[model samples]
Target: MRTLLLSLTLAGLLLSGCSPLPAPAVQPTQAQPAPPSPTQPPATPPQPTALAATPAAVPSPDEATPVAAPTSQGGSLPGGAIETLDPQAIIAATLRPDAPAWLIPADPELADMTRYRLDVTLAPDLSTLTGHEQIRYTNRETVALDVIYLHLFPNLWDGGLQTTDVRVNGQPITPTLPSGDDILGLPLAFPLPPGDSVELGLSFSIAIPAGEGVGNYGEFAYQEGVLALAHFYPTVAVYDAQGWRIETPSPQGDVIYADASLYEVTFTAPMNLTVVASGATLDHAAAGEGEAIWQLVGGPMRDFNIAASADYQKVSLQVGDVTVNHYYMTKDAAQGQAVLNWTIAALGLYQRDHGPYPYQELDVVETATSAGGIEYPGMVVVASWLYRDPNQRDFFQSATAHEVAHQWWYNVVGNDQLNAPWLDEALAQYSTYLYYLDAYGQTGGQGFLNAMDARWARVGHAAKPIGLPVGEYVNREYGAIVYGRGPLFLVALREQIGADKMTEFLRQYYHDDAWGIATPAEFQTLAEAVSGQDLDALFQEWVYP
Candidate 1:
């Protein structure tokens, strides 16, 4: 969730944005919706300190609104960047993403999860639209899969009854839930034959009012030309080696993933806008005059995302096989090389410390929406506030680092963020601290971590942990715990297990749960089992104690 806002805000113009640890994740109780570059710095052996000046972030434009296009500006890539191409295929090959290849690695069904490649075309009025999804399945269990279920989260966006037309392998069908597990309740549903695989294709219509989703617009926000979509479709909840861990989205919340998959997205918009999405661009084909199709190919990922705009300043950074891209608003703080340079250093440092980045290229798009940050698989959207003034550059850097780390935590590890929001987001938060430590140092890192802690104290203490259920927590408190307290929990856990053991524990945890969604209980079992010690109390403190 920490990375989500960045994934949203950057490409927005105060026009579209994702919420950050809001007061309550009270969604409509129905389905819900929600919404980086590296630059090179001097080889100064980046310090693991605050990304910038030493004050807690003041909810300025950069913090609240989404990213937007630059205003009449010309900013070049920083010192060590190559901004010429999208580099989508290069990375796809490296990730070797293959969905529906049941016998392959990105096995969604096996994990009780599946993903679809989507193509959408929206009318200018925002009230009418079209979408297509490519679905794949991989069975995680031995059950003979008689059907395939899909999610149409957008159904929740409107009135939960948008007319949709689906085609599985080119054959038209309607997979909406019927009977007990009503497809209408899910927004989408479908089935496939047992132990076999086939393509699930869909073409549907959707819409939104002009300037909708501007601010706190119910469970989700929607506006023509600007969209923040989540839970817009229906999907089968995940049930794996663990259990039925189906999570739902609520007000200002996010869900969890167990298995990461590949995403290939193609979107068409009025010719004047720019498109930013998950994965690399496979094709930028010309449609009729005044129109174009942006083909995005992303794989070895759990999910995919795409956003479009007419105004944006494109930027890219490449540091030893790792390349990242960022979009700045014409109305941002600083433009050009300044942004690029900082990002390059951030990306390189991240690559060296954690693990080889899984994706080939990173895309950061600015939005007019609000919120500090949000993360998708390979793409992210950030607010323009970080670029609103030169005084705020460092926060921009910190925000960038935080979102990039999500590719590892929430996306790759695939944990149940609802039950243990701390599992996914907290890990990402710690990852941010790691970035600061690498870029700044102990003093700087601690300071930044403390600031986040302070924010949590203000919020978490005021509300109760979201207790409705693990699924309900997606729109609940683990953010405060996982992101805010989760790191502190790690800090303490490190003390208990010894730093060396912490490393060994993570190595084993990753090895066991690689590309699979993990539950809090599963993680706890792993931790205790690895340390040869009991940690019920430790987890209790971090969560409820």
Candidate 2:
């Protein structure tokens, strides 16, 4: 299977800082870096061509398995074997525990997880974030390693971060050129071979990300005292079948599965300031004076994310013994109930249908600027203006549903969002529609179907074959093929097979691929196999010919 590519384009992020790696120190013994050249817009590279062959001789039933449907046919995704499951047991298990603990493949160069900690400071006044990353990499591989490479993540930022210095276990490493790229970027890189369990500490800074225009985020806008802090720290890059999944720009959010880390993140702000973040907070007491500590202890997240708003009003609710907190600017509080009500409804439906909420607390905040509602592990940040409109419930409802569903699709049911975007994006978008169907019946679903219809009408005109890798198509075109056409195919297939059977098939698919990623072709194969039908031609029409 082709290695998946995942990226989060936190572009148009407003930043101001000097050029180079970052002010914080990086791993030492590095090559010497050249003087900073004038940074310019990067030219797009030729898209990837097909690597695996086209579909060949059909598989015999005796040889048939879900794996053959996708991976063997020039398609990507590990397409690993499927497993049977008990639905009741799956539902009863906590969402965190329910995920498959994907075994770390026996790789010779990398070490297993030991422990990690990160301290990051964001300077709103400077629009720059300073961070310190600490991790223990033990060389479990047989080879004796020398140099190790580290990734300064969220490298997809428009201009990327510039590091001023680096230290290796406190020893400084020189550089040939600033260790990075424009198209696919990671701020710094280190070298490592084998049998070395060592600690890596790095100090780096990225311009505080804001969107294009003033208060403009991707597809959303910002309000007062609201801040969206993302890709704000140095992170370990991913290397797999496709090599280092470095600082590349991808349309969808990132596809990450960080092993484990103990995080002690602190935010110091003046009094009356409340913040909502990714992990647990150590609030010794609820004091209502002076500056407060927004301390976080993130247990198992690939990266840590947090949003702060000094003007935010705090509200809390409990859903099934799990506390759900909300932070929004005071002025936006007028419509806070609207979001809270819908979120509660969506949460209840998701738990009943798929699984339980995994984390102890779920935070929903209104960011100063951000894309449409985006989910981050247990927390979610969404635009408040959209939800405030009483008539715009469909947009709010669906966005809310989409982000929440991401908790299951990308977070637990892990898949690479870059190279194989269709895997999670399509699932999250459509699942929201499913939730709408469950809640408001056919009418609620019609809006999404209408969106699909609009997407098809717009994209079908330019009808590029969906067979090409996701990055080959325009962002909008990919949306049409994956989110619109893909779900419509599923809806049609469901009609062919009774819902009872289809639901069972979905359950099985979920159980089998819990921690695994997938490709579109594999899904077609599974749908056919589960329904005792064929989808070859269907895929030919919708995805490839």
Candidate 3:
């Protein structure tokens, strides 16, 4: 989520020396995990393919365990291998038969990735949601695991999430919420060895808060007949060299840090409302009287998001095999069309420079958000206020371009957004610059660069390191530095390396890390490799802490 302060008026706010109050920081007391052994090398980059043509062979029944389907009451299944699940069955269940070729995972390396199947229903008033999720998680780490952690992100707001009926492998289990209400720890019956997999079933109910006082960009709130549900479910946490990342998040930056996974969602909503969500809509039909059900599939992507409104009007255009849909209020039809145009332009430029977008559908929805824009896997939420204010046209364009660029940096090529946000956010900002250069030519590109200069000026051109964690910066520093000076660092690097090398570096980095998590070390290594110039001094002066 790009904060609201990225607007052109931020320079005036900095001149006035007034900033939003900082949220109190909650420091973690948990000991950090030891570093990886020296003998282990960094992960090799994956080939630039989306899905494998033929599925991997399923495990033999002798090697497989029986898994039970989740019951509505959250009861445990009978203790036998009554039903068995394999990778092919899970993939078939999650992916739509009519899904485009690109959405299928061609790379055999992604066979063990996590898969989620969700069945949820939204209240007629849009005040709450109740659902059950079945998660198929593989122990991708080298070391064995005794527990699994899940993040309940909506607990950070006034409303909260209640989880119940937790089961692992058809047996009931009690999970612990140790520190913050956001993290849930499930103790396994036994250690899950490396290369092993586990099935987790749980039921959750969420109280949707009103948008006014909801913080963290209000991405999870419901307001004025519009619902923006981001991270509305209990999502599994990523385990890295630092151990389970259950730290309480700072309100200043994006909340989720997760790997690419497959999602099959069955959502039931009021018939009057129109839904815009991540992924392709495989099925939409009447569920019952006055209600409708939508079956959607998205995958090998980071996260799933949804936006719904009874008053929404949509405009769509086909770009190649992908469809671009823009949803807006009835009164803002012209502005909605403009947004659609800009989105298509940016998407074309990004596809030319970066790789093709992996999904078959892209949605840009106008919802009530505190930030300029918030990006999910295949969808983005643009602030509704931007469409009403004519004076904010430039900010509107900048925000749209920035969020579309995230399709390449954040969704297709994954990163640890909580720690190394610059890997995506800074790159997205630079990609927005490329959009202006491609769409509007030199004059418009120079105008956008001047805005970047003004943004960095808000911090008085501070030489602060850009690689620090999100919590390390307080108040306006997070935006002023990460969103401001962070992009300038890329511009400087582009000058040091020739423009041609910089372009190749961006393309290579996208292909190499497609559908995988990236790190600061790997980023620098790739940049140096592409340029064939030692970037130690450049990173030391600009990026390193």
lDDT of each: 0.51, 0.48, 0.71
TM-score of each: 0.72, 0.68, 0.84
Q: Which RMSD values do the candidates have, in order?
A: 12.0, 18.4, 12.3
Model 2 bad stretches (over 4 Å): 1-116, 124-126, 137-160, 164-171, 175-198, 209-223, 251-264, 270-272, 284-291, 388-391, 461-470, 513-534
Single out the weakest 10-residue window by summed lDDT for candidate 3.
54-63
Stretches of candidate 1 exceeding 4 Å from the true structure: 1-19, 22-117, 124-127, 158-163, 167-174, 177-194, 212-237, 241-247, 256-258, 333-342, 389-395, 459-479, 529-532
Q: How would the candidate models be sorted by lDDT, starting from the highest?
A: 3, 1, 2
lDDT of 3 by residue, 60-159 (tens): 0001112233224333222212122343433454343454455456655456788777889999888899988878788999999999999998898766
Candidate 1 vs candidate 2, TM-score winner: 1
Candidate 1 residue 144 Cα shift, in angstroms, is: 3.1
lDDT of candidate 1 over 285-345, digit per residue (tens): 6687677776555555666666554545565545444456666554542554555554566
Best by lDDT: 3
Question: Cα deviation in Å at residue 488, candidate 3?
Answer: 1.0
Ranking by TM-score: 3, 1, 2
lDDT of 3 at 532: 99
Candidate 1: worst 10 consecutive residues by lDDT?
57-66
